[model samples]
Target: MKTIKNLFTALLLVLFLSAIIIACKKATDDPQPTPTPVTSITSIDPSTAPVGSTIAITGTNFNTNPASNTITIGGVTATIVSATATRLVVVVPTGAANGPVSVTAGGQTAQSAASFTVAIPSVKPVKEVRGTTFANQNWKKDTVYLIRGMVYIPADYTLTIDPGTVIKGAGPELDPTGQNISGTLVIERRGKIIAKGTAAQPIVFTSAKAVGQRAAGDWGGLVLIGKAAINRPASTSFAGGVRGVVETYSEFDDNSGTLQYVRIEFGGTSQPNAPTNKLNGLTLYGVGYNTTIDHVQVSYSSNDAFGWFGGTVNAKNLVAYRGFDDDWSSDWGYVGKVQFGVALRDPAVGNPAGSNGIESQNFDPGENADGPLAKQNGLPQTAPIFANISNFAFSSTPTVGLYQAGIFLSRNTAISLYNSLFYGYPEGLHLDGTATGTLANITSGALDLKGIVLANTLTPVVGTGVITNDLATAYFAGAGRTNLIVQTSDLASLLFNGANFTLTAPNFLPQAGSPLLTGAATGGKVADSFFTSVSYRGAFGTDNWISSWTNFNPQSTDYDR
Candidate 1:
């Protein structure tokens, strides 16, 4: 009996040991790391969703618990409905125009991944109604719509245009008025226009003509009229131009409309050197405030790329290339500020191919006309005033050299600048006036300048008997880089930042171990925004902003124009 009891106890012990071993094995092989819960957006719904359409987003690793969760595209917020460990759904919001869409979740951001395109319905035409007027009826593209010559905007109508829409100008020999063939877009009073474009599909206001063969001054630039602050002194012709008083009014300057991501090509000519002839890429007369103008480019105009007379308008991201006369010529009296501008000279266009970057001032010298009858009354004079001009680049060669000042500040012209760069010309900086211009005073007035760079190699600025390296560097930093090499990882910002260098893949800033990085004036000045770390020497910053895009190479053999 005693032996039997011992056998039973040993059996029980064995069973208990087997159960413990099984439990230990299960815990060791368990899969409980959780993987950190990663979430990434893969694609968007209705990828071609039109404007006002609700966009649905699909992605992985969505937060099942709806706390501390958010999603955005291009800095614009999106609405999320449902989320899970493997999927997320959201809707695109209004006022979110076309551009890149970046997704952020749990503090993680991914850019340059997917694009959000705004849908634009095809334009259809309506027969002439009571008060509606249409321009360019001759070049109609569809049956319901009028062709290239005429387009009608309803009274008080607001037109929304997507970027990348190439609106061709009227071809030659179509209109009898001669003004018609200038490929014009006229905005009437009391009308609103919104022509916006993005970087990828910028709205191009070009001619239907093929590329490469396109000539300068091919079409009439955009013409907008509004009621705002304008200095209309006496002697400033009203009939030839627009009539307005030199006064500041707080109201929306119709602009007639807004233009963005627009490129006006082959514009600016009054029929071959008539001088007084009227043609330009964009003509703003009596344009008012309350209009948005950004990323507007005017290339190869016969006259001026942008001409403003007797209006208060503000523009940004203006590019003037290879115009015959001036890149930005303001007459009568314009009161506004401009930023982020590039005036590039063309080696093949004008008699010299290069025109001055600016021809700014009131047309009436010494006459401060603020009214249609300013000559009779007398207020502030007729000269236009520029308040702020920051981040601008100018370049000129002997063949395309500007005849006068690179920045011609004519009669009573006032301007302020900050974080800007100017280079590549016969002279680094030029100020032409009867009275000695106030460098200190001008620098203090709304200029807010910090990082400024002035570099040149041609003639007096360099070579023997000219300014030495120390003096030139003191006066104009980075002058004559013909001997130096510029290392750049990105070309988009470099080109867009508004600096001049013949090579597309330019070495503007110091490299990882370059000597120029030690307190060197980047972009001709010492500003923080010009670079990420140890600022680049020119317009673009050497930070990660450039690491994404490919470098541009413009060689003598590779250059077309």
Candidate 2:
């Protein structure tokens, strides 16, 4: 009986050992649960540090690998000096503003409970700038540059301006020779200006007067001259050069550098010793195709907002607001391509010489005694392609009589316009100077206008000197043309927010169901690769390109601060 009990106990022990082994195997094969990592920001050392200062950030569950951790303060990326699982050391970025500090790691981001303050440094002393630049120079954003007189960037020199820089032009003053000392920036031939600013930080060139004291003609404007071809007489007022003199061998693709996201306000003063010679807000004199100019705004100018003398440069997203004279003027063999342009006029102000949205000409004197051949067929003629332009004259006010045509093409120029809108003008389109063969350009397909909409104009088409108004009207209403004519009463249905014409704020975007939203012409000059293809007829379909960087009420903004 003792032997039988001992055998049963041994069998029971073996069974128990087998059960334990099977349980151990099951446990080894099964997966384990991973704990979720917790990330939090405790604090940042030197919470108020200026740009480029080093700061230590304390956090939990940060990536041990420095490269794996991404740190941003005030929405600007910072350079990480070192990183640990629980802390990080970083240097503040140059453009960093006041905002919360955040650390992103291990696919998770942690934000601080409080915002980090960026210390404001003392006001940088204003630096006086005058004369010509002999060497490459950099204008820092922190310092305010005061242009006291005409400043020139000579050949082989470059002027680099940091983003968000403020350049103030002194008010017109008298020089020793009893001449007006205007503050103007002239970029001579072969010179460069790298004044590239961002959408968030646009460079501003404004008047030096106090906020309420600013007005048009407060200072001179910006001028750029390159070694591009120009078709002008030797006695040209702005820059003297004979036609075809440089057209065969000039640098059509010269690199005069960039000017992006820039604003020039309260400019356009008369040049010294020449009362008839007024400076435009921005003038391009023989600039070339390699020059970059885009996202530029010229406001409250006494003369034309933008004037292209001769160049092959292309531009986009240009704004001209409340200019006393023409918004855009092209002459002297300007063959550039421009897209997405906006022009808003103020009814309260007008130039006695006549104000128009666009004034294009091949030369000043169309019927020069020099004969018709030199005036009519100037080599490298003033033919520029402009697309998606929105011109608003606001002529419904009492000052409607002061405004002229929306577009005036004369002096035998072959400027082509496509997919554009012109509203509230006395005359929508004017073809002037029959002696100079201006009307012939339209018949010959040299100056083309397609996919155009004219609204609230007393005269939709006008022809002067020999081209009859009926002839001009027939061309606009020709077959295969998508031109539209809308009356003042029907403007509300054609535009989504057309009522807002206040100088403080204006809405240029087309509304849903508006004709400008679709049916843009794609053939002809618009088909060129220089223009961006869109189904919109105007400068804007739904997007507002003028937002954020543009300031419509510059007179109220205090630049001294």
Candidate 3:
């Protein structure tokens, strides 16, 4: 019996050993699981970087060995500085252009979802511009021009500025004659400035200070002098001219070349010779109708954004932003036609001499009185026509200070405004001075305001001096006049993005159901061929024209490379 038990035990041990051998053979014959190669580029830091710059690329399943990982930027092989399972630091290769970045690792290749832009090496050379130009000069876009002191384009000379050109004006400097020689550009009489730019690339004139250190009045502004009729005496010199004549003969259609899609920022410094005579952002002295002025933006001006001193230059699509003085000021004789203009004021900035959206005067207080009633009935009157204007004095309620009327007419001015929107001003319209002949002009249809909408104004109309407030009110609310007055609450329904008064970003476009979209009066002065016939009351209808090119936050723009 003991021998039989021993045999059973041996059989059991043999069966167990046979079972172990069979399992081992099956495991050896069957296929084993292999790790899945997961090599994928997740992201690239600084999608745009210059050559020789180090960039970190994040990915998945990358080789930990730096040499084992291969990276190419814009088809050029990059040197890997460090590597890990999920990240790789690589130096941008030479000859790398703007293209996709690829990585080859773990026997797999992966490309970035977005193209990597290899920034071109910036070698912005600075050119100091001073004195006058004797011959025709061309300013290229690749160089930065530092306007030091007063720079002038003499008579018969032409200054052509390429598109995307950057011209910076230096800070206030003292001349040998003790005059403040701020950086300024002056086009003499018969001289021309062909600075035409496209919507995608506008010519920029900004302060020379570094970013975030710029402010208004950092430099002088643009001055264009021409020969046109004026209300002042023929022999009276204006500005810095020895005589009033810019040309031998007065030509109404004298050409001053073109100024399109141009931006003037941080300009309008006060003149040292005349402290009260501050330089305007764009000063037109006797300019004529042949000058092409369109899509011009003036921002952060210490004086008037646009000042016309005896000029007949027609303009369109003008923008005046955050100006301390009058947004549009006209004196002497300005018989120009202006259309599609906007003035957006900043509540924090204002002129102590009083700020107005439109300030029109036939002549200064003590000038242009050559004969009897000459100040009131000059040879060439200030009878400019402005249409489709949107003048917002302030985005919101402003502190009571120097804010004045939306339209201020005095000194026998005969300016006309039509199809316009004026809001957020202390007074909507004011006719100052009794003997200014403004009341008579309005009665005779010389000084007219039609199809106007006034909102959020403390005083709708005011008449001082000879004109009576009751008469002004009667004229504004009289028959055949399509003027309407609304409150700030009602303005919300009239504007699509009305509350877009953010300092850095603003939206002046009308909403879908806005009243400004239709009911525009295209008759009278607006029917002229110079004005575009649009069925909109304000500067904008459906599209925001100032969106693409204009810079609202110019203080932060880095001009230097």
Candidate 4:
């Protein structure tokens, strides 16, 4: 019996050993579960969805979380709702045009076979907006609007316009006396306009008339009211507002708003109530130092392109293209800094009264010698500072009614201009005023000119009713002004695609070895905390900032398209 038990045990051991061998063979042959095949999309339910609607997208191998997946429709990023391996939900965005929906997940992408049909919202029309109040509302990018009548934005409101918005002003119906009325945009005191446009997508404010019929003064233009120090707190002209009296706050840093990369075209419409003209392309009324205005272009304005009425706001990269009247004008207590400015006078049209490149004043509208409208404290005067300015008046003979020069400084205006180029004018600089005007200011070191170039001017410098022409010319020809060149040539090679006053793609940058390419005065004289330090003069460097951005043909381009 013992021999029989041993034989049975040995048989059991053999069977166990054979089972182990079979298990080891199977373990060695086992395969890994295939990695979740790269995330992919199969289809999107409800292939069409309107803006702000939710969409359900079904896909395969998508990540379990929304952060791992991204979806876009019509190039507009959609707000993610939920994401799973087999499905994703998203909300369509505004300003999304009709286009295919695309899904990307974990290094894998998939697109819908057909485009998602997106219905565009009907365009809204704005007319005769005399009163409208806002509380931090955003004007979207997708809306193109037409404004009619006098649109006013009152105090304590914020109007944040998106990039690439095109706002058109339709001319008003004919009033009595056979004059075509104008539609105006007025930003009243304490109203803020936050229009920060991009270089690629600039905000355009223009006339709504057809291209061929469009002319200057189709609209009343932009009006801004801020609270800053002003010598004359109120304006004599009622159309723009009471000038010499402070309309807004008195804080120097009171933030009015931001205006960047904005183009105001075919503006300067006259108000029915005011003097001959009140608001120009852009009128800053008592704007404070905290207001920001840069990269602004005023094209084909009937009156002044940029006018400052008693404010301390600063500006940079200003372009006045083919304007009929003065390019830059200052009145009241406008204590501002302007850097990198360019003015091109219209060869065809010119204001008979004056079509100066720059005209400055201090309250005394009547060009007399009474001196500045003296303030109670005599504080915060009309002393505007300028640098890197280029004024090009292309016409040899004045236009039909033009009586203008490169610059006219009068009426107790205290100003300083440095590193500038003035050409194509009958007279370069004309300084005049009452007893406390330019003569007194210059003696007091409040009004001065340095590092200037005057070319093709019949008279380089003239002191009106004060110093003689020779004395004025000698004053500008003093030390540190050796690079100032005065010649008759238009300096054709220095500018690209520019001729006359209405040419396109104007490049103001000088060519290699040109005198304007170097020798700009630095330090506290021309230097200020408000401006970027640039060694070159004339509103440009080797790199052209206005090349890809500016629009020379606003009359032809349709804003809605």
Candidate 5:
């Protein structure tokens, strides 16, 4: 009986304990203590941003503790304005580049749930056109300019002309006796002049008259002054032949000027009686070696095209055409190198009835004892005349296309003509100076008749040298025409197949079978990628900026581009 009573009592106690244990478990499982609910991430404005633009942010989620939780924009903290659970505003840092924004609460970081992007602006085209004037008397810089009767560049001022800029001259036609805008340009005081131009848009210094109506000797030509080594005869005086009486100055490496792709037309002779009044395209009085000249064309000048008084500046890609007197005339102390020159005669025009392709020398041999044509002023003693004259065809008429040049190296001017084609002239190449001469100078010796072709159309002139048998045979072949025919497909392959020629303008392309398409020899220091084809020559190759020969006329009003 005692054992039963004890068991019952133990059961009751066990039941009570079980109930208590169940209640305790239920209380523990009720609900996780509500978190303090720290308001951190507020609100972000302008989810997107532009490069260099400001961004705004607002929110109270930023920590309110000392030093506050970091609210960064593009990794940089923003200027925290009002801070609250629902309001936190900050101006976007200016230097904050483009990226994401982060907000940190306590130690936890809330990744930029909102993303932003940078924007780009658009491009516009040129619409304004204005002319420059020299009316203001502001001569702080050592420069010169001219718009009308006003002179911006004084005789001693250095001038800088940007490429593709057109400068027009006004006033009388060559007669400088009357007060007009025809005064000579004197680059005294070692002043520098920079005229930079490109192949497509050459810097043109021309007269105000229309191109067709414009006459030679219209405006004064470019003049450069410098001090450097020059090539002159032992007996000749420095300033004997030139017509102008320019002031004297000396400067070596006159970091003054640069000229490229410049075209000066309808200049040369002026004041028929006054020789000093004539205009030469580019006249260098005492230019130094620091100046540069390339891809320059002086056409339809009344007198000589180019004349160097004294200097050592190299020139290349020079074309002189339709001049009344000599094409490339150099004399007084000129000691520079000229390469890739093309002196073409206008079959329609003639100079004093008869003249040759090129007329140059260390002295003005034809005019006086120091003239380029004089025997004493011939090559070997004069400055070294290194030129690459090729693919030239003179006029067929004796008055125009006589056996003059093809190649004329008179007065022993140390010159070398290689891989050149001369046609129509009675003489192929003339070496008449009292100096040593050689046939090896003609580059046709090494290659079979494939490179240079000289066709003598007129009766052979006695003084000019004879063409080599190989060159004559190779050029004439069977028809006697030395013209090289380039196919259209071949030109396209070279220009368009690769990145050789980029067609920036609308209609620039070489005509099929054009002579200008022949390629220059490989070894020469000619421009490698000037033309698209391996056979194209001259300034332009093939693109899409020019019209067909039949459709395009020089008299047309439409511009090329």
Candidate 6:
């Protein structure tokens, strides 16, 4: 009886302990916490941008994955560049309307307080423009501008010119007798330009004078100066407090700007009868490799249509039409790359001091041609590579000044011209002056003009002592196969414009049965991905690259207000 009574008391004690433990557990337990969603945009940077431009959007509660986030500009779907919890990068969509920019992420949406403005294509009336320093601003495609003075875009700023934007220079007439005070757009060092125009609507720079009165040197043309490698005289960088003049850049590729599908007409000013103080349709000074310049055309330029001074920029699809001087000039140690270009010369427009499709030299006439030698101070000795070019002297009665040629290489220039065509020039390829160093490169296979075709040239090759016309022709002929000196009639189907070389409606493509169609090499220095390899010896292949985006008729369009 005593054992049973003790067991019952123990059981009751155990039950009471169990009940207290259960109550304590229930009191200590807490509920799971939930986070609130955030849906707000604090701010936006560069609230305005054109189509196909990048813009940064900042806000809260953005998904980490860019694919999970949705962004729209002006109600159009924008391309997401990157995404994070606090920031997002997107490109303004094409054909986007003007409206609020919105973002939707993780089932939450946020709209910016300020609406994004759509860049409208507004046309401007003709008037005078230029002579002021341009700030860092976006020049929209809304209206055309008349540049009357020397307009400067200083460093730390960008001048964004939209496609279809017409900029006319009002110099000479705007400020007559003041040559230095021309309507010019100068991009100083550290400044950048992003003018990517399309073929259908290209960016045009022309004279402000009426069509009937317009002439070359009406005003200064587009000049781009950058901090890139150049072989200038020692210790001559940014001297004289000049804003645009730069000495050199350490890098091969410097990100300065882009100029694509652009046309400059009636530009290039000079003194009464000298090549001094002249400008080009497009001038690149110490430009870097990072710059993108292609699909450009210059017409009626008094000097070189496109000139380069000490830079490593690469260009393609260039057209120099009816220029008075050299179509393409390189000096001051320009070691860039050029391919697929066309130069059509009109006898009515030219000079007597030796005009050529290409004029290459290591330095200016006064500077040391071999000083610092080649590749000194990170500057190559005016060694340029020209491939797949078409140079046509349209004038049947070619009056060459100072021995004109399809190409002129002098002053110790180590050049490579391949897969090209030269027609109607006084001399197909002329190498003048003292160039002992450059000649060695030819024998060493470092400098050469292979697979070239010279049609109707009075003299195919001209060079210094030992490299006379006969020696040049023999050396070039023995160097490789596919080099030819043919008659103009043998080329077949190369139509001409009005009197000569106007090329109003040119068909540069050779006939199917022509030997030039199959004489091109498949591999070479220019056989990279950036360049399209063709089986033809000229600039044109099956592709019509010069169509649509280029402007051949600058005289008909009235760009002034």
Best by lDDT: 3
lDDT of 3 by residue, 167-207 (tens): 99987563323455778888888899999988998999999
> Regarding TM-score, does 2 or 4 come out ahead?
2
What is the per-residue lDDT of model 1 for residues 83-115, given as tens digits with 9 covering 90 to 100?
675555656665566666665666665543667
Candidate 6 regions off by >4 Å? 1-123, 126-129, 132-134, 175-180, 234-244, 271-275, 366-375, 395-397, 401-403, 433-435, 488-502
Per-residue lDDT of model 4, residues 1-561, tens digit only = 999999999999999999999999998899967765765556766777667778888878777789888888888788889987889998988777787888888788788777787755465444323335565666666776566666667789888878888888777573222344566677767889999998999998888887677899887888887777666534334344323345434567767899999999998877665547567899887788888999999998888899997778999999999788899999877888999998876566788676888898775556444555656323446788899898878545333247467878887778888788887777778877555666778767788777777777666677776656765667677775553646556545334223434466466766676667777777755667787787776776676777656898777765655
TM-score ranking of the models:
3, 2, 4, 6, 1, 5
lDDT of 6 at 553: 66
Model 3 alpha-carbon miss at residue 513, Å: 0.8
Candidate 2 per-residue lDDT over residues 1-561, each given as its tens digit: 999999999999999999999999999989999989888899999889987779999989998888998999999999999988888999998899898999999889999988999887676678888877699999988888998777888889999999999999886572222345777788878889999998999999999888789999888888888777777654445621101222332578888899999999999987655567788999888788999999999999988999998778889999999999999899888989999999988876888656898889886773452322363223547899999998888746324456888898887788999999888888888887664467778888888889989888888898886778998889888888888888777877775565447678888776678877998988777889988899998899888999899999999765554
Worst 10 residues of 3 by lDDT: 240-249
**How many clashes show up per model?**
45, 0, 2, 12, 41, 15
- Residue lDDT tens for model 5, 170-277: 434432234344533434434556677666656665554553566666655555556554444444332212233433333445544677877776655353244454
- Given candidate 3, what's the lDDT at residue 522? 64
Candidate 3: segments with Cα more than 4 A from true spot = 1-47, 50-121, 174-179, 240-249, 366-378
Estimate the TM-score of every prediction.
0.53, 0.76, 0.79, 0.73, 0.51, 0.72
Q: Give the TM-score of candidate 1.
A: 0.53
Task: Give the per-residue lDDT digits (tens) of candidate 6, residues 1-561.
Answer: 999999999999999999999998887785657778786788777777677668889889999899899988877898898988999998888888888889999798889989988664334655344554557656655566777556777778888888888888876456533544566677777789888899887888888787778888787788888777777754653311224445546677786789999999888775332336677888888888899999999988887899888778899999988788888888777877888998877766677777788888775565555432546567657777778998888446455563388888777677778888888788887865444555666666666777788877777778774466665667767845467887656544443223235556555655456666667855677676666777788787667788787656667655532
RMSD in Å for candidate 4, one decimal? 11.4
Query: How much is the lDDT of residue 398 in candidate 3?
Result: 46
Against the reference, the lDDT scores of all candidates come to 0.48, 0.83, 0.83, 0.75, 0.48, 0.74
Clashes of 4: 12
Local lDDT at 407 for model 1: 48
